[model samples]
Target: MTTITTRTVEYPADGLTMTGHLALPAGVGRRPAVLVGPEGPGLSDVERRRADALAELGYVALAFDVHGGRYLDDIEEMLARCMPLLADPDRMRGIGHAALDVLCTEPRTDPGRIAAIGYGTGGAIALELGRDGVDLRAIGTVNALTTGRAGEAARIRCPVWAGVGSEDPIMPPAQRDAFTAEMQAAGVDWRLVVYGGALHAFHHPPVDQAVRPGVGHHPEHARRAWRDVVGLLAECLPVTQ
Candidate 1:
């Protein structure tokens, strides 16, 4: 069995006590940390699986709750709930900063070996953290539905990797092209990988709900993305384990 210890973290933000899960790998020394932001499903089971998987790989992974306890049954409601947080740059930055503080303040975390990864709306949060100059070692995002603010990309000092599907209607190839150009122009070390036929929420497996459309699980793609994420983290963050 893999050695993993789970802890509950309370983030005091917006006067709300959001509950989050922190999984730590066993060791006596400080370890590289990854702050994972959950997707629109509102920190579903899959994200906990992701945190456990990362912990099994010998990293201290913290999956933070940005939506508090509010979960939406429909896509429209999820978007509506997340819009204000994303629109208000300060709130978006604050949310990510709070997660960072949790990770950095942890006794098992190596302050210098910190990174972040997010998906969908969480992807926007990851980008926001990078743009806010969080001193992260690396950053990763999946299907960034919302773009960062003006000049935010230029503020990112770490290597950034973005994975998106070519057939994603939410973020078309044209927009991906434009975003890639903007990153290049800003001199940010960035890369964009477009999966040939994958759609939005590609990382999440299909659920029993009948309301979700254009959502399907691609385990192969998910595995590939994990490899890329692990490689990026290892390259950027110090090997503290």
Candidate 2:
């Protein structure tokens, strides 16, 4: 196993002191970096572990925070905070950019070689960053097939890859179509994968908290999605040994 380092980082976003997890690879020189976004409930051990996994793969990774170090396990509470935030594109961009700033500031990060990968609300934030004209090599999202303001997607300069469960009510066929339409109209290179028989947030491991309908885990699909995301990164932001 690669010898990696991890730490907690604090940064301000959306009027909150966001505490994120930063993971550094084993080797010395600056390496490609990736921004890992968590589900709407907020950052958890899941995302932090993903950051560590990315670090083990030789990339500097930062799993960003959305709720100021709090994890909302209640479905209603999660929606209460995420709904309004999702409605405002600028707010999402603010959070994404803040995390990007922290990632870029790391001495080991290759600022120019970066990609964004996120789940649920975090996925939406990644798409928002792409729409905001951020220079990203790639954008990979799962369970967040959100459409942006008209013409905004045209600003996205990188290839985008998205994954969703076919049975995900939150991101149903209509939402997926709309998202794809927007990306197509903008002429952005993009791809979408539908995991059959899966539900919303299928990539996430089972949690003890109560979840809304159409939210469950599929261990197999979860592994597949991670492989897909890793493949996307390898193609767009390869790490040098």
RMSD per prediction, one decimal? 1.7, 0.7
Q: For candidate 2, what is the lDDT? A: 0.96
Assess candidate 1 and give its TM-score to the true structure: 0.93
Question: 1-241, model 1: which lDDT tens digit per residue?
Answer: 6788988888876556777789998776788899888886677667777888888878888888877755555778887878777777778788788878898898988888888998877778888888888888898888874566777778888998999876788788787977787788779999888776788877777554654556666788877877887788778874653
lDDT of candidate 2 over 97-116, digit per residue (tens): 99999999999999999999
lDDT of each: 0.79, 0.96
- After superposition, the stretches of candidate 1 with alpha carbons farther than 4 Å from their true spots are none
Best by lDDT: 2
Instruction: Evaluate candidate 1 by giving its C-alpha RMSD to the native, one decimal.
Output: 1.7
Give candidate 2 regions above 4 Å deviation: 209-211
In model 2, residue pairs whose N, Cα or C atoms come closer than 3 Å (at least 3 residues apart or on different chains), thus clashing, are none
